[model samples]
Target: MELIFLGTGAGIPSPERNVTAVALALNEERGTFWLFDCGEATQHQIMRSPLKLSRLEYIFITHLHGDHIYGLPGLLSSRSYHGGTTPLTIFGPAGLARFIETSLQVSGSHLDYELRIEELQEGVIFEDEQFTISCARLEHRIDSYGYRIVEHDLPGRLDRDRLIADGILPGPIYQQIKLSKEPIAYEGRLLDPKRYVGPDIPGRKLAILGDTRPAPNALQLAQTVDVLVHEATFAEAEAELARRYYHTTTRQAAEIAAQAGAGELILTHFSSRYNREDLAWLIQEASRYHKPVYAAYDGYQHPIPRK
Candidate 1:
Protein backbone atom coordinates (compact mmCIF):
# COMPACT_ATOMS: atom_id res chain seq x y z
CA MET A 1 0.00 0.00 0.00
CA GLU A 2 1.08 3.57 -0.69
CA LEU A 3 -0.19 7.10 0.02
CA ILE A 4 -0.30 9.50 -2.90
CA PHE A 5 -1.07 13.05 -1.76
CA LEU A 6 -3.16 14.61 -4.49
CA GLY A 7 -4.29 17.87 -2.81
CA THR A 8 -2.56 18.71 0.44
CA GLY A 9 -3.33 22.36 1.10
CA ALA A 10 -6.01 23.54 3.47
CA GLY A 11 -9.24 25.34 2.51
CA ILE A 12 -8.04 26.57 -0.89
CA PRO A 13 -5.78 25.60 -3.75
CA SER A 14 -2.40 27.23 -4.28
CA PRO A 15 0.48 26.95 -6.74
CA GLU A 16 2.31 24.82 -4.22
CA ARG A 17 -0.63 22.65 -3.25
CA ASN A 18 -4.19 21.76 -4.29
CA VAL A 19 -6.71 21.00 -1.52
CA THR A 20 -7.19 18.06 0.88
CA ALA A 21 -7.42 14.72 -0.92
CA VAL A 22 -5.23 11.62 -0.51
CA ALA A 23 -5.06 8.48 -2.64
CA LEU A 24 -4.42 5.22 -0.87
CA ALA A 25 -3.03 3.14 -3.74
CA LEU A 26 -3.42 -0.50 -2.90
CA ASN A 27 -3.02 -1.59 -6.50
CA GLU A 28 -0.50 -4.25 -5.55
CA GLU A 29 -2.71 -5.56 -2.78
CA ARG A 30 -6.19 -5.33 -4.26
CA GLY A 31 -5.82 -3.89 -7.74
CA THR A 32 -7.60 -0.67 -6.71
CA PHE A 33 -7.27 2.72 -5.01
CA TRP A 34 -9.00 4.23 -1.98
CA LEU A 35 -9.30 7.95 -1.37
CA PHE A 36 -9.68 10.18 1.66
CA ASP A 37 -11.29 13.60 1.29
CA CYS A 38 -12.35 14.62 -2.24
CA GLY A 39 -11.41 18.29 -1.98
CA GLU A 40 -12.22 20.87 -4.67
CA ALA A 41 -10.68 19.95 -8.04
CA THR A 42 -9.47 16.65 -6.63
CA GLN A 43 -10.29 15.03 -9.98
CA HIS A 44 -7.81 17.40 -11.60
CA GLN A 45 -5.09 16.09 -9.34
CA ILE A 46 -5.83 12.48 -10.25
CA MET A 47 -5.56 13.31 -13.95
CA ARG A 48 -1.92 14.25 -13.40
CA SER A 49 -1.04 10.94 -11.77
CA PRO A 50 -1.05 7.21 -12.61
CA LEU A 51 -4.31 6.79 -10.66
CA LYS A 52 -7.27 5.28 -12.50
CA LEU A 53 -10.53 6.74 -11.19
CA SER A 54 -12.41 3.67 -12.40
CA ARG A 55 -10.37 1.58 -9.95
CA LEU A 56 -11.51 3.63 -6.96
CA GLU A 57 -13.19 1.14 -4.63
CA TYR A 58 -14.00 3.53 -1.80
CA ILE A 59 -14.01 7.24 -1.00
CA PHE A 60 -14.02 8.57 2.56
CA ILE A 61 -14.92 12.17 3.19
CA THR A 62 -13.72 13.72 6.42
CA HIS A 63 -16.55 16.24 6.88
CA LEU A 64 -18.96 18.36 4.88
CA HIS A 65 -16.43 21.17 4.52
CA GLY A 66 -16.05 22.47 0.98
CA ASP A 67 -12.37 21.70 0.74
CA HIS A 68 -13.10 18.17 1.95
CA ILE A 69 -15.95 17.21 -0.39
CA TYR A 70 -16.62 19.79 -3.10
CA GLY A 71 -15.07 17.61 -5.77
CA LEU A 72 -17.30 14.60 -5.15
CA PRO A 73 -19.93 15.45 -7.75
CA GLY A 74 -17.39 16.13 -10.46
CA LEU A 75 -15.28 13.08 -9.69
CA LEU A 76 -18.27 10.78 -9.56
CA SER A 77 -19.60 12.18 -12.80
CA SER A 78 -16.22 11.85 -14.48
CA ARG A 79 -16.06 8.22 -13.42
CA SER A 80 -19.20 7.50 -15.43
CA TYR A 81 -17.92 9.45 -18.45
CA HIS A 82 -14.74 7.41 -18.43
CA GLY A 83 -16.79 4.20 -18.92
CA GLY A 84 -16.36 2.98 -15.38
CA THR A 85 -18.66 0.07 -14.51
CA THR A 86 -17.35 -0.71 -11.04
CA PRO A 87 -19.67 0.24 -8.21
CA LEU A 88 -18.25 2.92 -5.90
CA THR A 89 -19.01 3.31 -2.21
CA ILE A 90 -18.57 6.66 -0.43
CA PHE A 91 -18.45 6.98 3.35
CA GLY A 92 -18.64 10.25 5.22
CA PRO A 93 -20.25 12.12 8.11
CA ALA A 94 -24.04 12.58 8.33
CA GLY A 95 -25.61 14.31 5.27
CA LEU A 96 -22.97 13.09 2.79
CA ALA A 97 -25.53 10.83 1.13
CA ARG A 98 -27.90 13.74 0.65
CA PHE A 99 -25.11 16.05 -0.45
CA ILE A 100 -24.05 13.85 -3.38
CA GLU A 101 -27.60 13.04 -4.45
CA THR A 102 -28.61 16.70 -4.25
CA SER A 103 -25.59 17.91 -6.16
CA LEU A 104 -26.10 15.34 -8.92
CA GLN A 105 -29.79 16.13 -9.10
CA VAL A 106 -29.28 19.89 -9.24
CA SER A 107 -26.76 19.51 -12.06
CA GLY A 108 -28.83 16.89 -13.93
CA SER A 109 -25.89 14.52 -13.77
CA HIS A 110 -26.51 10.91 -14.76
CA LEU A 111 -24.27 7.95 -13.99
CA ASP A 112 -23.78 4.62 -15.80
CA TYR A 113 -22.52 2.65 -12.80
CA GLU A 114 -23.71 2.23 -9.23
CA LEU A 115 -22.96 5.23 -6.99
CA ARG A 116 -23.41 4.35 -3.34
CA ILE A 117 -23.16 6.85 -0.50
CA GLU A 118 -23.40 6.21 3.23
CA GLU A 119 -23.49 8.80 5.99
CA LEU A 120 -21.62 7.23 8.84
CA GLN A 121 -21.97 7.35 12.62
CA GLU A 122 -19.16 6.71 15.14
CA GLY A 123 -18.63 3.03 14.52
CA VAL A 124 -17.92 0.38 11.89
CA ILE A 125 -18.99 1.62 8.48
CA PHE A 126 -17.57 -0.79 5.87
CA GLU A 127 -16.00 -4.21 5.56
CA ASP A 128 -15.13 -6.70 2.82
CA GLU A 129 -12.99 -9.75 2.26
CA GLN A 130 -9.84 -7.65 2.35
CA PHE A 131 -10.40 -4.88 4.91
CA THR A 132 -12.63 -3.59 7.70
CA ILE A 133 -13.22 0.13 8.21
CA SER A 134 -14.41 2.02 11.28
CA CYS A 135 -14.75 5.65 12.27
CA ALA A 136 -14.78 7.81 15.41
CA ARG A 137 -15.92 11.37 16.02
CA LEU A 138 -13.25 14.05 15.84
CA GLU A 139 -13.03 17.42 17.55
CA HIS A 140 -13.73 19.70 14.64
CA ARG A 141 -16.06 22.62 14.17
CA ILE A 142 -18.30 20.36 12.11
CA ASP A 143 -18.97 16.72 12.90
CA SER A 144 -15.75 15.34 11.42
CA TYR A 145 -14.55 11.76 11.73
CA GLY A 146 -11.28 9.80 11.77
CA TYR A 147 -11.18 6.55 9.82
CA ARG A 148 -9.36 3.32 10.55
CA ILE A 149 -8.73 0.61 7.92
CA VAL A 150 -7.61 -2.80 9.06
CA GLU A 151 -6.52 -5.36 6.44
CA HIS A 152 -7.32 -8.97 7.11
CA ASP A 153 -4.50 -11.36 7.95
CA LEU A 154 -3.33 -13.61 5.10
CA PRO A 155 -2.66 -17.29 5.21
CA GLY A 156 0.88 -18.57 5.88
CA ARG A 157 3.18 -19.53 3.02
CA LEU A 158 3.60 -23.21 2.37
CA ASP A 159 6.97 -24.91 3.08
CA ARG A 160 8.15 -26.15 -0.28
CA ASP A 161 11.44 -27.45 1.13
CA ARG A 162 9.72 -29.71 3.66
CA LEU A 163 7.46 -31.15 1.02
CA ILE A 164 10.31 -31.70 -1.43
CA ALA A 165 12.33 -33.55 1.22
CA ASP A 166 9.45 -35.93 1.79
CA GLY A 167 9.52 -37.13 -1.85
CA ILE A 168 6.58 -34.83 -2.71
CA LEU A 169 6.84 -32.24 -5.47
CA PRO A 170 5.40 -28.73 -5.32
CA GLY A 171 2.11 -28.31 -7.22
CA PRO A 172 -1.57 -28.05 -6.29
CA ILE A 173 -0.67 -29.55 -2.90
CA TYR A 174 1.14 -26.34 -1.98
CA GLN A 175 -2.08 -24.47 -2.71
CA GLN A 176 -3.95 -26.85 -0.49
CA ILE A 177 -1.41 -26.36 2.29
CA LYS A 178 -2.02 -22.62 2.22
CA LEU A 179 -5.78 -23.08 2.44
CA SER A 180 -5.97 -26.28 4.47
CA LYS A 181 -8.18 -26.62 7.51
CA GLU A 182 -6.45 -29.76 8.75
CA PRO A 183 -3.53 -32.06 7.95
CA ILE A 184 -3.65 -33.76 4.56
CA ALA A 185 -2.15 -37.06 3.49
CA TYR A 186 0.45 -36.38 0.85
CA GLU A 187 2.46 -39.26 -0.64
CA GLY A 188 2.43 -41.92 2.13
CA ARG A 189 2.48 -39.60 5.19
CA LEU A 190 -0.02 -37.20 6.72
CA LEU A 191 1.46 -33.74 6.18
CA ASP A 192 0.66 -31.29 8.95
CA PRO A 193 0.83 -27.75 7.49
CA LYS A 194 1.19 -26.18 10.91
CA ARG A 195 4.58 -27.86 11.36
CA TYR A 196 6.06 -26.73 8.03
CA VAL A 197 4.31 -23.43 7.23
CA GLY A 198 5.69 -20.02 8.02
CA PRO A 199 3.97 -17.76 10.54
CA ASP A 200 0.70 -16.17 9.42
CA ILE A 201 1.21 -12.59 8.33
CA PRO A 202 -1.08 -10.04 9.91
CA GLY A 203 -2.61 -7.46 7.62
CA ARG A 204 -1.36 -3.90 7.73
CA LYS A 205 -3.47 -1.09 9.17
CA LEU A 206 -3.88 2.48 7.85
CA ALA A 207 -5.53 5.48 9.48
CA ILE A 208 -6.58 8.62 7.62
CA LEU A 209 -8.37 11.66 9.05
CA GLY A 210 -9.33 15.15 7.97
CA ASP A 211 -9.52 18.55 9.69
CA THR A 212 -9.79 18.24 13.48
CA ARG A 213 -8.28 19.48 16.70
CA PRO A 214 -6.24 17.27 19.01
CA ALA A 215 -8.51 14.56 20.37
CA PRO A 216 -7.95 11.24 22.20
CA ASN A 217 -10.54 9.65 19.93
CA ALA A 218 -8.28 10.32 16.98
CA LEU A 219 -5.55 8.41 18.74
CA GLN A 220 -7.85 5.41 19.19
CA LEU A 221 -8.61 5.25 15.48
CA ALA A 222 -4.92 5.55 14.63
CA GLN A 223 -3.55 3.11 17.17
CA THR A 224 -0.63 1.07 15.74
CA VAL A 225 -1.35 2.15 12.21
CA ASP A 226 1.16 1.68 9.43
CA VAL A 227 0.38 5.13 8.14
CA LEU A 228 -1.47 8.03 9.78
CA VAL A 229 -2.58 10.72 7.33
CA HIS A 230 -3.60 13.67 9.49
CA GLU A 231 -4.59 17.27 9.04
CA ALA A 232 -1.83 19.56 10.24
CA THR A 233 -3.24 22.90 9.24
CA PHE A 234 -0.91 25.13 11.24
CA ALA A 235 2.56 25.34 12.62
CA GLU A 236 3.24 24.71 16.28
CA ALA A 237 3.47 28.49 16.86
CA GLU A 238 -0.21 28.89 16.05
CA ALA A 239 -1.66 26.38 18.50
CA GLU A 240 -4.25 28.83 19.88
CA LEU A 241 -5.48 29.84 16.44
CA ALA A 242 -5.53 26.21 15.33
CA ARG A 243 -7.86 25.39 18.21
CA ARG A 244 -10.03 28.37 17.37
CA TYR A 245 -10.33 27.15 13.80
CA TYR A 246 -10.91 23.55 14.87
CA HIS A 247 -7.65 22.40 13.26
CA THR A 248 -4.44 20.82 14.42
CA THR A 249 -0.90 22.19 14.67
CA THR A 250 2.15 20.20 13.58
CA ARG A 251 3.15 19.56 17.19
CA GLN A 252 -0.36 18.51 18.19
CA ALA A 253 -0.45 16.06 15.26
CA ALA A 254 2.92 14.66 16.28
CA GLU A 255 1.60 14.13 19.79
CA ILE A 256 -1.39 12.32 18.37
CA ALA A 257 0.89 10.17 16.19
CA ALA A 258 3.07 9.30 19.15
CA GLN A 259 0.12 8.41 21.35
CA ALA A 260 -1.32 6.22 18.64
CA GLY A 261 2.02 4.46 18.00
CA ALA A 262 1.74 5.05 14.29
CA GLY A 263 4.77 3.86 12.32
CA GLU A 264 4.82 6.82 9.95
CA LEU A 265 3.09 10.20 9.73
CA ILE A 266 1.94 12.12 6.65
CA LEU A 267 0.85 15.66 7.48
CA THR A 268 -1.42 17.37 4.96
CA HIS A 269 -4.00 20.17 4.68
CA PHE A 270 -1.32 22.83 5.39
CA SER A 271 -2.30 26.45 5.64
CA SER A 272 -1.24 28.65 2.71
CA ARG A 273 0.56 30.92 5.11
CA TYR A 274 3.65 28.74 5.05
CA ASN A 275 6.02 28.68 2.08
CA ARG A 276 7.77 25.69 0.49
CA GLU A 277 11.07 26.50 2.24
CA ASP A 278 9.24 26.47 5.59
CA LEU A 279 7.85 22.96 5.10
CA ALA A 280 11.15 21.45 6.19
CA TRP A 281 10.86 23.25 9.52
CA LEU A 282 7.24 22.19 9.84
CA ILE A 283 8.19 18.55 9.31
CA GLN A 284 11.09 18.92 11.71
CA GLU A 285 8.72 20.28 14.31
CA ALA A 286 6.62 17.14 14.00
CA SER A 287 9.69 14.89 13.81
CA ARG A 288 10.65 15.92 17.32
CA TYR A 289 8.17 13.39 18.71
CA HIS A 290 7.81 11.06 15.74
CA LYS A 291 10.35 9.86 13.24
CA PRO A 292 9.66 9.86 9.50
CA VAL A 293 7.24 12.78 9.66
CA TYR A 294 6.38 13.87 6.13
CA ALA A 295 5.02 17.25 5.07
CA ALA A 296 2.92 16.31 2.07
CA TYR A 297 2.56 18.31 -1.14
CA ASP A 298 0.46 17.64 -4.21
CA GLY A 299 1.82 14.68 -6.24
CA TYR A 300 4.00 13.47 -3.37
CA GLN A 301 3.97 9.67 -3.00
CA HIS A 302 4.88 7.53 0.02
CA PRO A 303 5.37 3.87 -0.84
CA ILE A 304 6.06 2.28 2.53
CA PRO A 305 3.21 1.37 4.89
CA ARG A 306 3.75 -0.04 8.40
CA LYS A 307 2.05 -3.17 9.64
Candidate 2:
Protein backbone atom coordinates (compact mmCIF):
# COMPACT_ATOMS: atom_id res chain seq x y z
CA MET A 1 0.00 0.00 0.00
CA GLU A 2 1.10 3.54 -0.75
CA LEU A 3 -0.05 7.03 0.26
CA ILE A 4 -0.01 9.86 -2.24
CA PHE A 5 -0.41 13.42 -1.03
CA LEU A 6 -2.38 15.37 -3.60
CA GLY A 7 -2.38 18.58 -1.55
CA THR A 8 -0.73 19.43 1.74
CA GLY A 9 -1.58 23.01 2.65
CA ALA A 10 -3.67 23.96 5.67
CA GLY A 11 -6.59 26.35 5.23
CA ILE A 12 -6.05 27.62 1.71
CA PRO A 13 -3.99 26.94 -1.40
CA SER A 14 -0.48 28.29 -1.63
CA PRO A 15 2.04 28.47 -4.46
CA GLU A 16 3.96 25.51 -3.08
CA ARG A 17 1.07 23.49 -1.68
CA ASN A 18 -2.66 23.15 -2.28
CA VAL A 19 -5.46 22.17 0.14
CA THR A 20 -5.79 18.77 1.89
CA ALA A 21 -6.22 15.67 -0.22
CA VAL A 22 -4.69 12.18 0.11
CA ALA A 23 -4.96 9.05 -1.97
CA LEU A 24 -4.30 5.60 -0.53
CA ALA A 25 -3.36 3.40 -3.46
CA LEU A 26 -3.91 -0.35 -2.96
CA ASN A 27 -3.13 -1.50 -6.48
CA GLU A 28 -1.31 -4.66 -5.42
CA GLU A 29 -3.84 -5.70 -2.80
CA ARG A 30 -7.20 -4.49 -4.11
CA GLY A 31 -6.62 -3.03 -7.54
CA THR A 32 -8.24 0.26 -6.47
CA PHE A 33 -7.50 3.38 -4.47
CA TRP A 34 -9.25 5.26 -1.65
CA LEU A 35 -9.30 9.02 -1.19
CA PHE A 36 -9.20 10.96 2.06
CA ASP A 37 -10.23 14.59 2.50
CA CYS A 38 -10.80 15.88 -1.03
CA GLY A 39 -10.11 19.58 -0.76
CA GLU A 40 -10.62 22.17 -3.52
CA ALA A 41 -9.10 21.31 -6.91
CA THR A 42 -8.54 17.74 -5.75
CA GLN A 43 -9.71 16.39 -9.10
CA HIS A 44 -7.20 18.60 -10.83
CA GLN A 45 -4.49 17.19 -8.64
CA ILE A 46 -5.56 13.62 -9.37
CA MET A 47 -5.48 14.41 -13.09
CA ARG A 48 -1.87 15.43 -12.69
CA SER A 49 -1.03 12.23 -10.83
CA PRO A 50 -1.31 8.57 -11.87
CA LEU A 51 -4.53 7.98 -9.91
CA LYS A 52 -7.69 7.32 -11.89
CA LEU A 53 -11.15 8.56 -10.91
CA SER A 54 -12.69 5.35 -12.23
CA ARG A 55 -10.57 3.28 -9.81
CA LEU A 56 -11.55 5.40 -6.81
CA GLU A 57 -13.56 2.94 -4.68
CA TYR A 58 -14.00 4.84 -1.44
CA ILE A 59 -13.76 8.35 0.04
CA PHE A 60 -13.33 9.12 3.72
CA ILE A 61 -13.99 12.72 4.65
CA THR A 62 -12.37 13.84 7.87
CA HIS A 63 -14.67 16.80 8.49
CA LEU A 64 -17.12 19.08 6.76
CA HIS A 65 -14.67 21.95 6.62
CA GLY A 66 -14.60 23.76 3.29
CA ASP A 67 -10.91 23.05 2.83
CA HIS A 68 -11.53 19.33 3.36
CA ILE A 69 -14.63 18.83 1.23
CA TYR A 70 -14.91 21.61 -1.35
CA GLY A 71 -13.56 19.42 -4.15
CA LEU A 72 -15.80 16.43 -3.42
CA PRO A 73 -18.74 17.47 -5.55
CA GLY A 74 -16.63 18.39 -8.55
CA LEU A 75 -14.70 15.13 -8.33
CA LEU A 76 -17.86 13.10 -8.03
CA SER A 77 -19.39 14.82 -11.04
CA SER A 78 -16.27 14.31 -13.09
CA ARG A 79 -16.21 10.63 -12.20
CA SER A 80 -19.57 10.25 -13.92
CA TYR A 81 -18.46 12.25 -16.90
CA HIS A 82 -15.47 9.94 -17.23
CA GLY A 83 -17.75 6.88 -17.34
CA GLY A 84 -17.10 5.45 -13.87
CA THR A 85 -19.51 2.57 -13.62
CA THR A 86 -18.23 0.93 -10.45
CA PRO A 87 -20.11 1.69 -7.23
CA LEU A 88 -18.55 4.21 -4.83
CA THR A 89 -19.00 4.62 -1.10
CA ILE A 90 -18.34 7.81 0.85
CA PHE A 91 -17.92 7.88 4.60
CA GLY A 92 -18.03 11.14 6.52
CA PRO A 93 -19.48 13.03 9.43
CA ALA A 94 -23.09 14.11 9.58
CA GLY A 95 -24.33 16.76 7.10
CA LEU A 96 -22.05 15.27 4.44
CA ALA A 97 -24.93 13.47 2.81
CA ARG A 98 -27.00 16.64 2.68
CA PHE A 99 -24.13 18.62 1.22
CA ILE A 100 -23.47 16.08 -1.55
CA GLU A 101 -27.17 15.56 -2.33
CA THR A 102 -27.79 19.28 -2.56
CA SER A 103 -24.73 19.86 -4.73
CA LEU A 104 -25.72 17.17 -7.22
CA GLN A 105 -29.36 18.32 -7.26
CA VAL A 106 -28.55 21.97 -7.71
CA SER A 107 -26.10 21.28 -10.50
CA GLY A 108 -28.39 18.70 -12.16
CA SER A 109 -25.55 16.21 -12.13
CA HIS A 110 -26.31 12.50 -12.30
CA LEU A 111 -24.00 9.63 -11.45
CA ASP A 112 -23.51 6.66 -13.72
CA TYR A 113 -23.02 4.24 -10.84
CA GLU A 114 -24.34 3.54 -7.36
CA LEU A 115 -23.26 6.10 -4.79
CA ARG A 116 -23.49 5.18 -1.11
CA ILE A 117 -23.01 7.82 1.56
CA GLU A 118 -22.46 6.63 5.12
CA GLU A 119 -22.61 9.01 8.07
CA LEU A 120 -19.83 7.95 10.36
CA GLN A 121 -20.11 7.09 14.03
CA GLU A 122 -17.24 6.73 16.50
CA GLY A 123 -16.57 3.03 16.04
CA VAL A 124 -15.96 0.28 13.50
CA ILE A 125 -17.70 1.51 10.34
CA PHE A 126 -16.50 -1.03 7.79
CA GLU A 127 -15.24 -4.63 7.87
CA ASP A 128 -14.72 -6.98 4.97
CA GLU A 129 -12.73 -10.13 4.47
CA GLN A 130 -9.51 -8.22 3.91
CA PHE A 131 -9.74 -5.18 6.16
CA THR A 132 -11.42 -3.60 9.19
CA ILE A 133 -11.82 0.15 9.46
CA SER A 134 -12.69 2.09 12.61
CA CYS A 135 -13.04 5.76 13.43
CA ALA A 136 -12.81 7.87 16.58
CA ARG A 137 -13.96 11.40 17.24
CA LEU A 138 -11.23 14.04 17.31
CA GLU A 139 -10.92 17.42 18.97
CA HIS A 140 -11.46 20.03 16.28
CA ARG A 141 -13.59 23.17 15.83
CA ILE A 142 -16.24 21.01 14.25
CA ASP A 143 -16.89 17.27 14.61
CA SER A 144 -13.90 15.48 13.12
CA TYR A 145 -12.58 11.93 13.10
CA GLY A 146 -9.48 9.77 12.73
CA TYR A 147 -9.54 6.47 10.92
CA ARG A 148 -7.68 3.22 11.66
CA ILE A 149 -7.35 0.69 8.88
CA VAL A 150 -6.16 -2.82 9.71
CA GLU A 151 -5.47 -5.32 6.97
CA HIS A 152 -6.23 -8.95 7.68
CA ASP A 153 -3.34 -11.30 8.31
CA LEU A 154 -2.36 -13.21 5.20
CA PRO A 155 -2.05 -16.96 5.07
CA GLY A 156 1.41 -18.42 5.17
CA ARG A 157 3.24 -19.68 2.10
CA LEU A 158 3.31 -23.37 1.30
CA ASP A 159 6.33 -25.42 2.26
CA ARG A 160 7.40 -26.26 -1.24
CA ASP A 161 10.48 -28.25 -0.26
CA ARG A 162 8.51 -30.34 2.21
CA LEU A 163 5.80 -31.01 -0.36
CA ILE A 164 8.42 -31.91 -2.93
CA ALA A 165 10.07 -34.30 -0.51
CA ASP A 166 6.70 -36.01 -0.11
CA GLY A 167 6.49 -36.71 -3.85
CA ILE A 168 4.09 -33.80 -4.47
CA LEU A 169 5.74 -32.14 -7.48
CA PRO A 170 4.91 -28.53 -8.31
CA GLY A 171 1.40 -28.68 -9.73
CA PRO A 172 -2.15 -27.32 -9.22
CA ILE A 173 -2.65 -29.81 -6.40
CA TYR A 174 -0.08 -27.91 -4.34
CA GLN A 175 -2.44 -24.94 -4.25
CA GLN A 176 -5.33 -27.18 -3.22
CA ILE A 177 -3.27 -28.63 -0.40
CA LYS A 178 -2.34 -25.17 0.86
CA LEU A 179 -5.84 -23.70 0.68
CA SER A 180 -7.84 -26.64 1.95
CA LYS A 181 -9.40 -26.07 5.34
CA GLU A 182 -9.43 -29.81 6.10
CA PRO A 183 -6.93 -32.48 5.28
CA ILE A 184 -7.02 -33.76 1.69
CA ALA A 185 -6.61 -37.45 0.85
CA TYR A 186 -3.71 -37.97 -1.55
CA GLU A 187 -2.06 -41.29 -2.28
CA GLY A 188 -4.03 -42.89 0.60
CA ARG A 189 -2.59 -40.28 2.99
CA LEU A 190 -4.07 -37.13 4.50
CA LEU A 191 -2.31 -33.84 3.56
CA ASP A 192 -2.84 -31.31 6.34
CA PRO A 193 -2.25 -27.61 5.61
CA LYS A 194 -1.07 -27.12 9.18
CA ARG A 195 1.84 -29.43 8.47
CA TYR A 196 2.65 -27.93 5.06
CA VAL A 197 2.14 -24.17 5.60
CA GLY A 198 4.49 -21.80 7.39
CA PRO A 199 3.48 -19.36 10.11
CA ASP A 200 0.85 -16.74 9.24
CA ILE A 201 2.18 -13.39 8.04
CA PRO A 202 1.22 -10.40 10.18
CA GLY A 203 -0.82 -7.68 8.56
CA ARG A 204 -0.15 -3.96 8.42
CA LYS A 205 -1.95 -1.22 10.38
CA LEU A 206 -2.38 2.43 9.34
CA ALA A 207 -3.91 5.52 10.93
CA ILE A 208 -4.93 8.74 9.19
CA LEU A 209 -6.07 11.61 11.37
CA GLY A 210 -7.99 14.73 10.56
CA ASP A 211 -7.46 18.30 11.78
CA THR A 212 -7.32 18.34 15.56
CA ARG A 213 -5.46 19.28 18.70
CA PRO A 214 -3.66 16.57 20.66
CA ALA A 215 -6.51 14.19 21.49
CA PRO A 216 -6.53 10.80 23.23
CA ASN A 217 -8.50 9.30 20.37
CA ALA A 218 -5.68 10.17 18.03
CA LEU A 219 -3.34 8.04 20.08
CA GLN A 220 -5.91 5.26 20.19
CA LEU A 221 -6.35 5.32 16.44
CA ALA A 222 -2.61 5.38 15.78
CA GLN A 223 -1.42 2.86 18.35
CA THR A 224 1.42 0.77 16.91
CA VAL A 225 0.40 1.56 13.35
CA ASP A 226 2.89 0.95 10.56
CA VAL A 227 2.23 4.48 9.29
CA LEU A 228 0.61 7.39 11.11
CA VAL A 229 -0.54 10.30 8.97
CA HIS A 230 -1.29 13.40 11.06
CA GLU A 231 -1.56 17.12 10.44
CA ALA A 232 1.14 19.47 11.59
CA THR A 233 -0.41 22.75 10.67
CA PHE A 234 1.97 24.93 12.66
CA ALA A 235 5.55 25.04 13.79
CA GLU A 236 6.59 24.29 17.35
CA ALA A 237 6.94 28.01 18.15
CA GLU A 238 3.25 28.49 17.37
CA ALA A 239 2.03 26.05 20.00
CA GLU A 240 -0.29 28.60 21.57
CA LEU A 241 -1.79 29.56 18.24
CA ALA A 242 -2.14 25.94 17.30
CA ARG A 243 -4.00 25.17 20.51
CA ARG A 244 -6.28 28.15 20.06
CA TYR A 245 -7.14 27.07 16.53
CA TYR A 246 -7.46 23.36 17.47
CA HIS A 247 -4.55 22.45 15.18
CA THR A 248 -1.49 20.41 15.98
CA THR A 249 2.08 21.67 15.81
CA THR A 250 5.04 19.75 14.39
CA ARG A 251 6.39 18.80 17.81
CA GLN A 252 2.94 17.81 19.07
CA ALA A 253 2.28 15.56 16.11
CA ALA A 254 5.64 13.86 16.48
CA GLU A 255 5.08 13.40 20.19
CA ILE A 256 1.78 11.69 19.48
CA ALA A 257 3.45 9.38 16.95
CA ALA A 258 6.14 8.51 19.46
CA GLN A 259 3.62 7.78 22.20
CA ALA A 260 1.59 5.63 19.83
CA GLY A 261 4.71 3.68 18.78
CA ALA A 262 4.10 4.28 15.12
CA GLY A 263 6.74 2.91 12.79
CA GLU A 264 6.85 6.16 10.79
CA LEU A 265 5.37 9.65 11.09
CA ILE A 266 4.07 11.61 8.07
CA LEU A 267 3.10 15.22 8.67
CA THR A 268 0.80 17.12 6.35
CA HIS A 269 -1.61 20.09 6.26
CA PHE A 270 1.12 22.69 6.59
CA SER A 271 0.21 26.34 7.08
CA SER A 272 0.55 28.68 4.10
CA ARG A 273 2.85 30.89 6.10
CA TYR A 274 5.65 28.35 5.73
CA ASN A 275 7.37 28.21 2.38
CA ARG A 276 9.51 25.45 0.86
CA GLU A 277 12.56 26.54 2.82
CA ASP A 278 10.60 26.28 6.11
CA LEU A 279 9.69 22.64 5.52
CA ALA A 280 13.18 21.48 6.44
CA TRP A 281 12.84 23.25 9.79
CA LEU A 282 9.46 21.61 10.36
CA ILE A 283 10.96 18.18 9.71
CA GLN A 284 13.83 18.92 12.06
CA GLU A 285 11.38 20.02 14.75
CA ALA A 286 9.29 16.88 14.40
CA SER A 287 12.39 14.66 14.30
CA ARG A 288 13.29 15.78 17.80
CA TYR A 289 10.30 13.87 19.16
CA HIS A 290 10.11 11.04 16.58
CA LYS A 291 12.65 9.66 14.19
CA PRO A 292 11.82 9.01 10.51
CA VAL A 293 9.51 12.02 10.37
CA TYR A 294 8.44 13.16 6.92
CA ALA A 295 6.87 16.46 5.89
CA ALA A 296 4.42 15.82 3.07
CA TYR A 297 4.21 18.10 0.04
CA ASP A 298 2.02 18.06 -3.02
CA GLY A 299 2.50 14.81 -5.01
CA TYR A 300 4.59 13.22 -2.24
CA GLN A 301 4.27 9.44 -2.07
CA HIS A 302 5.08 7.12 0.83
CA PRO A 303 5.02 3.38 0.40
CA ILE A 304 4.11 1.30 3.46
CA PRO A 305 6.19 -1.83 3.73
CA ARG A 306 4.93 -5.13 5.10
CA LYS A 307 5.83 -6.14 8.62
Highest-scoring model, TM-score: 2
Residue-level lDDT of model 1, residues 261-290, one tens digit each, is: 998898889999986788899999999988
> In candidate 2, what are the lDDT values of residues 1-307, reduced to their tens digit?
9999999999999999989999999999999999999999999999998898999999999999999999998999999887789999999999999999999999999899999999998999999988999999999999999999999988788999999998888988888877777898888888898889877788999999999999999999999999999999999999999999999999999999999999899999999999988889999999999989998999999998786
lDDT of 1 at 271: 94
lDDT of each: 0.88, 0.94
Off by over 4 Å in 1: 185-189, 305-307
Residue 293 alpha-carbon offset, candidate 2, angstroms: 0.4
lDDT, residue 206, candidate 2: 94
Best by lDDT: 2
In model 2, what is the error at residue 269, expressed in angstroms? 0.4
